[model samples]
Target: MKRIMLTLILLVGIGGYTTYAQSELSLQECLKYALTNNQQLARIRMEEDMGRFKTSEVRAKALPQVNASGQYTNNIKKQVLAVPGELIQEPGKTVLLEAGTTHNVTASGTLTQTIYDQSVFTGLKAAKAGEEYYSMQSVQSEETVIYNVTQLYYSTLVSREKMIVLDANIEKISKLVNTTGSQVESGLARKIDLDRMRVNLTNYKTQRTQAQNQYLVQLNQLKQQMGMSMAASIDLPHTSFKEIESKAVGALDFGGVNLDNRIEYRLLKKQEELQEFQKKAYKAEYYPSLALSGNYSYNGISNKFDMFKGSGSTASWYSMAAVSLTLKIPIFDGFARRSRVSQASVTLKELNKQKEETALALNTQFENAKLQVQNNLTTIQAQKENVDLANEVYNSTQNNYNLGLANLTDLLDAETSLTEAQNNYNEALLQYKLAELDIIKSNGNLKSLLN
Candidate 1:
């Protein structure tokens, strides 16, 4: 019996844990989760790392480069050297003697160091700029992810609230249908009225099903934006209509949005910076470069395989060394460097144009977002009042219908009005939230959402 009780207790504990695991997630939690798990953001981070490695590679050019080489040869047929016979005291005759050893081995090491290379220096600077460019891109990508996730999160919340409203309407109308049927049986209500109530109840149920399905679809989309698994069961916390209205009403103004705050504008500026570096790099090609090279080698020659043993004078080994400094003057290249510099200057001008355009566009976005925020705030207030009035009318009509002072049609109409008002109010809140998110992004404060 004790074992049975223990098993029951363990089962209950597991069930509770499962329920807790699937509990509702708030907006902050969702944003934080996306930042950590988003696949796109992860790729951007890897690209940033690639930029750093690229810079390292360019810097490596300035360091001394060393290499080793070895070769072994076994001559099958040595070439004969023909000499004048008179020189060997044999008149009017030619003599032939074989040249070179049967076996030969050589090993060498070399080092090359750049003393003054204009191109390598330019490349190092360009690489550093590229790394910074990638870093900015990463930040921009994160902001985009945060904006998308926040938008989807609130959209899902709105859909869920609509579904809730429909469910409540169904429940209320179902009760009305039951009451009307009893009235018709007792001769207090006509059969037509009972049938009408049943039809309305059926319609509400159908509408509720659609609303619930839409809510489910939206929830799945929210999970997708959050980088959560499709197979995972998750819930979103419910936000009341009144709370939404209050939040919208209290929307803060981010006065005088700075173009520098917006990541898009900053990215453009960073591009301009990189283009300037590129222009300098192209111009750097006109300059000369100097390098120092050193080499050391060991040669071994023998008629037998005894070079490593160094046995007697039959096998011989010698060491050779050389050092030289080379200067490469860019005398001419068919005016290629001049043409490249001209193109870079043109590109810089284009980038300057882009920066100007981006600045104007960013300003326009901020202004439009602020305008929308104001408009949504007004709509939310009006809708909030409409909802309250509709609820009052619904309650009064419902009570009157119960007392036979109102017809089923009037009650149904009032319920419809209430449902519309509630949905409109929720829609206004969603628009306001979206506009607020835009304001935050335009002000370069999307990361504030995580806080």
Candidate 2:
């Protein structure tokens, strides 16, 4: 019984340790985990594999193809042929003879090698380019996942920080409530003052509860983005706001935004390349094709159903073989090739238009991100000053109330203003961080977060 109890205790301890280890995840670790486990990203990887297989299939078309086949037949009702009596040396008489054999077996093998086919060659190129396009698409998908997970992590961190601030405020208010209650009982403070303090304490506690709930909601969302179970518990370090600000301050130093750096632009360019190949493939349809082919077959015929073991004198067997070079000239196809070529041409034109549109959109996003980063930085600086001023005012008010030079109402109001300023600063910090991420992304540096 003691051994059993010890075993149970050990199991619980191990489970706790495992959960704690999993909960201690940094931003980079979370991004890495999501890349490995995300369902959407997994699907994109599967498609990338499919693309490779498709390329192999296209390449196979250019190689020689060999096939073998076999067949067994019973001519249950052979066709009869009418023969002229004179031809058979029987004048004025006709003869009817059965054609073919009662039993037949045949086996054959064939080989076809493509010598030259413009369309096939062009298709192979297109398939290779298509594979490259899928690869680029997979990279684009990874970038997207990284961006989402990072944003959620920052948001959840800010929410948690806000809850921390609320808890601190609640603790301060609770202490003040106790002090005021003691003063009221000893006749050093009024009943009204104590009652007002209690009211403020209640309000702070309520706010703390709301902030806690919001933090949990944001944490759940972060978990979802990381492809983590909703029921899992996670612990993010209390990363100082100053640390985040310091890291983000130099985000713009990544320099100029080049359209080539953006994955979306790169993917579109790859698609355009594939489309060019498609146009060539359609045009190639008008060209002729050449191929080398060979066939070999053996046939056995017997009146008895004994193709495998028939006596040599009772069964007849024959073999046939042939080799040829085939060249096909496309004379006409009722203008089909011409129409398809025109369609491919038009599609290429549309792709070019899309490229132009994408270029414009990319530039717009970069400009917007730059503008937002500048604006958010300015806001953060201003809010930081506000927080400092509020803190100073609260401290002075508290001192005045302690010396009996200020009313309880004034002190409580000062505290409220200070809390408001702190929250505003936190919100500004969040905006700044989000804008910083945008700037990094616009500069095509999201992959840097992986480090």
Question: What tens digits encode model 2's per-residue C-alpha lDDT throughout 49-92?
Answer: 99999999999999999999999999899999999889889988
Q: lDDT tens digits, residues 1-451, model 1?
A: 0000001111332321212253344567677777877878889999999999999999999999999999999988998999989989998989998999999999999999999988788889889989999999999989989999888877877887888888888888787778777878899889998788788778888888898788788867766776666555655545664655665558564677888888888888888887888888888778888999999999999998887774455788899999999998888899998898899889889988988888888889889998898899899999989999999999999889778798778988999999999999899988988998888988899998887
Q: How close is every model to the real structure, measured as TM-score?
A: 0.91, 0.91
Q: Candidate 2 local accuracy as lDDT?
A: 0.81
User: Lowest-lDDT window of 10 residues in candidate 2?
Assistant: 1-10
**lDDT of model 2, residue 57:** 94
Residue 51 CA displacement from its true place in model 1, Å: 0.8
Off by over 4 Å in 2: 1-23, 244-254, 310-313
